[model samples]
Target: MTTEEIRAEARGQAEAHLRALVGSDSAVLRDDQWSAIEALAVDSRRALVVQRTGWGKSAVYFVATLLLRSRGAGPTVIVSPLLALMRNQIAAAERAGIRAVTINSTNIEQWQPINDAINAGEVDVLLVSPERLNNPGFRDEVMPRLAATCGLLVVDEAHCISDWGHDFRPDYRRIRTLLADLPPGIPVLATTATANARVTADVAEQLVSATGEQEVLVLRGSLDRESLRLGVVRLRTAEMRLAWLADHLAEQPGSGIVYCLTVAATQEVAAFLRDRGHEVAAYSGQTDPTERAALESALVEGRVKALVATSALGMGFDASLGFVINLGAPQSPVAYYQQVGRAGRGTDDATVVLLPQLEDRDIWAYFASLAFPPEQLVRQTLEVLAQAPGSMSTVALETYVELSRNRLETLLKVLDVDGAVRRVKGGWVATGEPWSYDADRYARVAQARQREQDAMLDYLDTDRCRMRFLRDQLDDPDATDCGRCDNCGGLTLSSSVTEAAVDEAGAALSRPGVAIEPRKMWPTALANLGLDLKGKIGDGPVEGRAIARLTDLGHGQALRALFRADAVDGPVPPPLASALLTVMKDWAGDWTDRPVAIVGVESASRPQLVGDLATGLSRVMQIPVVGRFAIVDASVAPGQGAANSAQRVAAIHRRFRLEADVPAGPVLLVDDLVVSGWTLTVAGVALREAGATAVLPLTLGTQT
Candidate 1:
């Protein structure tokens, strides 16, 4: 058959597949979708589809998979990013009569069966997270087989493969290796709804065949979502934002998302909304996998009014979510666009509101602090790994390094991608390959991030069409005034929250106290650091209480003010003192034993506040002030408190000594703040060793 005749036949099959996939008798593929499908199935070329959400990007791949399989090609391998996305895709694939299975962290037990089915040619599409591609077992055993036999490779959320993208993941870089290993002429497709000019170019460049045998077909389109009505509500206080959400959430279109910048905010906002009779749930990275799935289902099925979430819910969660309200602005316009894109996907009208507060920049700074470490620190990490005899676990490496667990893990991933390290079954090992720190590249990225931040600020204050402004930030060539946004028309939402709602929100915020879960297990291999600690912390403090989290919406703001570097070291404020009394009262009410005395943890930064808190509590509880732990060695370096558990433990082990006499029985341990909790742990252990029966920890704030 002629090429045109063959294209016509393939187009007919694609329409049939599209109809089956959407369960619509009259459904047909868009011209762009058909173009992507044809490139993948007929031309066997690489394709990148950068279109708006709900624009049928998935249809292109699913249809292409069926077309390729009809000619006896192997099952398609989809490198998806999130579990929610995988679930959505699997369901969609089933609707199209395609067999789809997934192997993710959640479904480990099913991996063998899934692999067997794939090998038996019973699975038409196998979805796996990008992280799984780097797994030693999967990479060594399954990936090569899949790469050799796979008909088409799909990289969903392809923008993540580029470090220039708003939401970059190191694991996505593993796609380059997979691409290189693919059999010659195998088709590849990468799709994303959120990528600007830079990210698009980076992703498209990454999609080029290692052999230079095929050029990628780039299909870019407008990112305008016509159903979205964008607006911003500038609230002067976090309390006001909470109040607005409480008073106006139910009046919005349907059940939606209330996005918060921090996990503490999610919990606080969800709790406040629920107290106001809204059926909302809090979600964050700290939530368990099972609970996350259930919460996603709840939001999708409309079982709850909304899910107060962090960016953990940002990526491929599919539902006809009616609205998305940001309690705080994301750091960049790109991130804000990706998040707001979640709304109005399947509806003719959806509300997208951004509640920008003064605290948003502080939150952004906190996240920015976790970026790539300095060159010196990177060198130190490499030296530690190089000097090691075998693969070192992250916890073990933490003893010698000053980085936190999260930062250390991230650095290791970047190093691995740079070929300076390798991830093995046991842990990570130095690759012994010469690697140069790309200072210029990293600086450029950082500068780009700053520019994005500036653009987001511009977006918040822009008088032009909000949608158009965002699209322009994304380099959308077809950006135009939507005539639906608040800026284009008038303010779509009211800044006025009822007095009663404000008071209610204030009361909720005023209520403080977050449980401080004590450390149960010691950092592994402390012996390497000249400390003998290992295994469970048998003598550690029991569960403790903090007046608030440093990230909390209510008392947290005050606590943050009190803990700022430039803040005066004064006695506890009257309001915080009163809240502390309430916390103590509630805490004592549930205790099996009352504290016989108060002991203070040594405070280098807030000695006045910690000492004052201990004395005030002593007077209220009618207990003696047993005295405080002394800083035996004040020689520790600055910022040592923020190090990982092992380092913090080692630092505290040498610095803290119980210099005061302690009468037995339970005692209340007070501190200005609990960061790593190692200071409290060490104090608790020392007190327990000094004959205290039990130690109860109480702090003004806990750094989350």
Candidate 2:
């Protein structure tokens, strides 16, 4: 597209005020962002921003939408990552006091409200999920009503279109088709945080091939959160590991989170910590919906002081909780970022203490054992979308080749992620009829896709920077060490090789109580390097065995390693052996600067409390340090709160709870993960009543 062509998409009046509105509100756009936006606005060349956390991506959409709207531009249809995100954005717009509406799977009737708004010429933005973009609801009732109203189409978390993204959702792959179907020349925009080379290239491909446009504006902010300090500890044994956690917790202020890889581990840790006097709250898949809500409430209401949970804690969770204490090594860097991101929403410094525990494989392997069969998925999808018994709906199967729905609800969801199928009476019917069908090809493709998924399991076994490896598969070929990632942070461990970190405690312990670290661990080791903690030797350790690495370490070992490897003070703890590794293998094809903020805090003068845990030893250290850790009151240690007080538990669960249920002045929703986004929608509605002006959703990773 030429400059003139790009200008034509937005009316002349829109092009004038766009720049000013680009970074306003909670959008937080930076310099690089402007460069990307400018390049996109003026040049025909493709420009993209490969940003990380804290980088404003949604601002780009809002700016563009507002710009186009100024010129009497039609509505901008944004392909939301989740229903929750759409609701959040609506809440934000309402909070901003801007009239915006969205429709999703849960509320098909929303189409009426949205259509009414479009007809009244009252809506500025139309947020829809990709699945909904091609749905009968949008095509028949919504799209035709707003066809002339929609000027621009935006795909949030565009990386999900490709299998390479951290959280790939099949439905995103079909977004390009929907764009292609839209009346010619409608400019399409997309944004994402977790994009690598493969994903980036995919995005470019999507813009060119699917949308039939060469000028796609790609704007990204930085990836670094410098205010958040980095520290890595090699596991010795379970006993030593637990002791090390005790010591690390002793040094931090506010309640912290300890993420486990398994529900059993979460339960065990919570029990152990509770017995040890820490107000430990546990959350896992096993916890019912009510219990989960209670747990979330506990964190927000300031009921519990500390929490032990599995990956369940990171999904759309919003809390200014003080610290993120990791008891288990995350399966991926994306997972790690999200679990830790819950802590630093406030301006106050917060701490994310990562204690890598070799995870138990029984859980993930069990997941594999329970994975739904491809054939079943396909058949169920067809069944749900079957037309009403009396009448048939002509829906093209090829158009939905890439749709995604909740696995648990695969049988119930007659439509795709977009909610297109219309249920009249007993049977169901969808809009798009099968364009062409090669049953053989469908079967082959289905199986091949299943095999491709096997690659994720393989990813778990690879020795590369988990983040880099994932991005390369999705975005770029030249992508290398993102300098800020764990791999770039100087951490490296090959899955093919088995080498134990230094075990000599005497050498690591320089002072009587202080542990002399072998070498300061690079960021990569903190984020990558899968170590087996359940006590297995050789290749067996690579498989999910709990090789008892840190927990087994005796008395002399635990505190010493804690003082050496985990402590981030004075200077470097261990000599980074991976400097050569990083220089030689540089996984990140290119280095993208990340957003960073740092501030100083005076040490607190308070007493530290250490305790004996149930069947374990737990100690609570007074709030001594407060950096990268947010706590309302640092003085109260973990054990100070009631063992079962809802207020106390709520405080501890705060990491997963929203600050307020009501919306304030155009409140923006900030989250690390975007799944179905329904959770965020619930949050958005809650925020609205609480006085939030409007609400928008910001997610680091969206399964678009």
Give the number of the best model, judged by lDDT: 1
lDDT to native, each model: 0.89, 0.46
Q: What does the lDDT read for residue 337 in candidate 2?
A: 59
Residue-level lDDT of model 1, residues 382-415, one tens digit each, is 9999999999999888888889998998889888
lDDT per residue (tens digit) for residues 576-685 in model 2: 11121232123112213211211111112211100111001101112111111123455554323122122232223332223433312333343222333333443444
Maximum-TM-score candidate: 1
RMSD of 1: 1.5
Q: What does each candidate score in C-alpha RMSD?
A: 1.5, 22.3
What residue pairs clash in candidate 1, if any at all?
A: none
Q: Stretches of candidate 1 above 4 Å error?
A: none
- Give the C-alpha miss distance for residue 374 in model 1, angstroms: 1.4
Kindly give the stretch of ten consecutive residues in candidate 2 with the minimal lDDT sum: 609-618
